[model samples]
Target: MVTKLPLAVLLSASMLLSGCTVVDLDENGQPILPKDPAAKASFSSQTPQQIAQENWDSRVLKGAQDRALTWNDMKNKSTALKAETSSSVFVKATGTVTAVSDDAERERLLTVTINGESVPVAIGPVIRSNAIRDAAGFKFEEFTNQVQFARLTKALNQQNVQQLPKIDGSWVGKPVQLTLAVTLQPQRIEDAVAVVIKQEQP
Candidate 1:
């Protein structure tokens, strides 16, 4: 014999199984929901360049400033500073290029001087790191390896390089403003590589 259930019990069971009590359907049978205003606003406000610049300014620039050191400071207190900070230090310097390395196949290292102390800036061949991204408050676990990080670095490097003068004989004496993310290892400041290099407009 079949047992009949009450209307209220059947409706409750159906609602529980469906996982939704109310579903507003449009004329076309699709869900009728309001557009997300916040999503729309975000989409309209953030351009690719603006987003990238924000990341650069907030993460890369701020990260550098957190433990900033001058060329002379790094030279004299490399060991002490590295031991104290135990992370990459950002170096900001305005200097003229005294020499440019002859290596064309690999990264181009520009030897510049701030108060007569030499600092090398690396340009190209490889721009890979999540240091800036991490500094921008992004977690590495969100990505699969360095692919996204590499893309960010590559775009940044390209934008910076485009604004810089060619690394040739002519660039040897030109003034440049460099902001670098330098690894604090082996107690050497000259081994620092520039993450951003901008030529001072004369």
Candidate 2:
């Protein structure tokens, strides 16, 4: 049967179709949010763990494979490398482990020698650098907020550390091959391994 519809109802449906949110207001003219969420309630998250899952394969490992600078190139010719690099870079290093810091596992550091350059690599229970995050080449301005940016940093660090093999004093003299994320104008011995992809030890 043909029936006439209210103009208001038609207009409301049109507004909804146009992506306008249907918010309810209270007496004071403020939004009256829902008490219990509905089935379609949604939230967005890119936590460290989630981030790790998304980027670990295509971005972290693969990207490192494509964009990494040799340890010697990163250390000896950094200025020239920086001039050519317009974004984040990975430093690939392979060397024998010389020492391991006994600090909290999160704060642990492993010393390795690559191309005669001895440096500390942080394999964290707590990573203190933004190596992987920055190496992803994301711009800070594009982040919705500092909190999101921090989440990305945590995510990258988590992704990298998850790939690390177990380590201890026994690992000394074992050959380790890893990738690190470092800035063009690095100050510290460069942040440690973004990931330990190969460990030549039993």
| Top of the candidates by lDDT | 2
Total backbone collisions, model 1: 0
Q: Write the per-residue lDDT of candidate 2 for residues 1-202, one digit (tens) a residue.
A: 9998999999998988999678999999999876553332121344546656876788777878888888667665455554335335788877888898775565888888877868787887778777777776655654546777778777777767767877878878888777777655532344565475467655
Residue 29 error, candidate 2, Å: 49
**Per-prediction TM-score to the true structure, in the order listed:** 0.50, 0.66
| Model 1 score (lDDT) | 0.61
Residue 44 accuracy (lDDT) in model 2: 35
Per-residue CA lDDT of model 1 for 25-97, tens digit only, reads: 9999998886654443332344435556656656656776676667667555666664435345566778998
TM-score of 2: 0.66
User: For residue 26, what is the lDDT in candidate 2?
Assistant: 90
